[model samples]
Target chain A: MRDLSLHIIDIVQNSVRADASLVNLTIEISGEVLIIRIGDNGCGMTAETLQKVTDPFYTTRTTRKVGLGLPFFKQSAEQSGGELIIESEVGVGTVVTATLGLHHLDRPPMGDLSETVSLVMSGNPQVDIVFTCKDDKNEFTLVTTEVKEILGDLDISMPKVTRFLREMIEENLIELKLKIE
Target chain B: MTKVKSLDDLKKMREQLQSQVSLRVNSETPEKMVQVKVSMATCGIASGAKEIMNLFVNELDRRAIDAVITQTGCMGYCFAEPTIEVTIPGKEPVVFGYVNAQKANEIIEQYVVAGNLVDGIIPANYETVKDQKNK
Candidate 1:
């Protein structure tokens, strides 16, 4: 909730909890607009569930039910002069997209994304994630499998792994910003 | 800016030495220095890892526990996040999961300060390749 990456992480957790096998996250930044899209091949939500999900008090899980995550995300998008859209098909999949005015002061800061990616890749080793980051000038793709192959059985909990993820994200952002400049 | 060519060069750097020397020179140093690594991976963040990380850092700083806090990626137990790894120098690194502010204090007081293991540990059987090959 502190940043777009945190929101993405929260939503992806819901997807994983829904038994998702594949999750695709796309971030597109152009001019002053930033769009984030996440699609998951998980058990899609029912119409009733979807309607209540943004209520901040409804949750399907029995573990601490007062769900505020999705609502928070929706509010964040709206406050940023953007919108949140969700589409789901029962037994098919789910997709959530949030567009934000990057220059808007109301928009939450982009939190630590390198930590987010590394966490997801390491935590859900069986589940695949395709992450794409793009701007007017440059784009980068990160697939979980490639990192796993590179790391082998080395603990992703290590500082080196975190450093690699941080470096990757920072470098890509710098490259993209340079192109814009 | 001159680039450091080797580890030795890094050891002679201004920032690192200054921090280390200052830490050493400072009086009222705690008996022990607890090194805490907060896992800020995607799973950890989803499970409120940021809040937990901040809580620990603030609490430790408030109490002036000679702790050097940092962050790591994922600890692989997506279900039981936000995970935290604590190392007390001579002791083995212990990873705790589902950490909250309350639990973090207990860790700082009991496990970190008193050397007692709290609950919420993922089994040690979950080994990395280094551990597997060593076995």
Candidate 2:
């Protein structure tokens, strides 16, 4: 993943693949640290699989031999003087947390997050994804469940709905621009 | 944050805007709408697939083209990063590579809208898992 947003997208895809109906993704920037967490109620890994998830060579998917998603995200965080952690149970769920030094030179930019959210939603309309981005000065949260309620059985991935979701995300995140500077 | 007071208020608003919203209850039927799948794996994102996906969505809306856009995992074309598969009604799916915003625009204007094939069509050498299943 080139940016933090893309990293989030990669990790969330794992949850979707795990048969998770809900995924909660959080991105927080506080002081000098940037933090990301993805929690999912999915068919979580056994302790054995969780132990090796960070290994670039280990993958649960049979279609591929190497699963680089977690390893790449771990590398990105660790390169910025931070750490990645995974907590999972066999049938309960899993949560992945990564912290990065925000000001570190190696930290990739926080790329197009609205696009990231839209892509995830478009790809998994049946799943509920709750995304929250918080900084010291501002915070924005979007729950697809709520959006669905507003939409009333109209698919969220429909062109107008997607357009609305993209604009809603972008419009909310725009409040954080002044805070970023 | 304070747009609607309650569920009833939101529902009222939804009813007001429902006329403008097209209802496509099923996104799976390719015969009903143009089906587009953008590869969104890590490599794809690193290669600007995110931007291309957004371009397709926004441009399709601007053109009022009824298309179902989706994001999918890598199609084992890491070398051909930023690839997208477009399936028009009654047509075989075509995968296009190296799709930036410009190429995506060309795809929309030429291939998707006009039914005229443009450049950047990668040979559909690999079969998707879904394709294999249907076969």
Which candidate number maximizes lDDT?
2
Candidate 2 residue-wise lDDT, B1-135, digit = tens: 524133344456566445544453234343567888888776787798878878887888787676778778778677778999999888999999989888899999999989999898888767654456567
lDDT of 1 by residue, B42-119 (tens): 457767886676566556646645564555655556678888988886777888877888888898888877888898
DockQ score for candidate 2? 0.33
Compose the digit string of candidate 1's lDDT tens values, residues A1-181.
Answer: 6677788767877777778899998888878988889899999999988888888878664334467668888999999999999999899999999999988989888776655665555445567788788887778777766655554433333333433454565566565552111
The DockQ-based CAPRI class assigned to model 1 is incorrect
Best by TM-score: 2
Error of 1 at A119 (Å): 2.7
lDDT of every predicted structure (CA atoms): 0.68, 0.78
Model 2 misplacement above 4 A: A62-64, A136-138, A176-181, B1-31, B119-135
TM-score of chain B of 1: 0.69
Off by over 4 Å in 1: A155-159, A178-181, B1-48, B51-115, B118-135
What's the C-alpha lDDT at position B12 in model 2? 63
What class would a CAPRI assessor give candidate 2's docking? acceptable
Question: Chain B TM-score for each model?
Answer: 0.69, 0.75
Task: Output the lDDT of residue A119, model 1.
Answer: 52
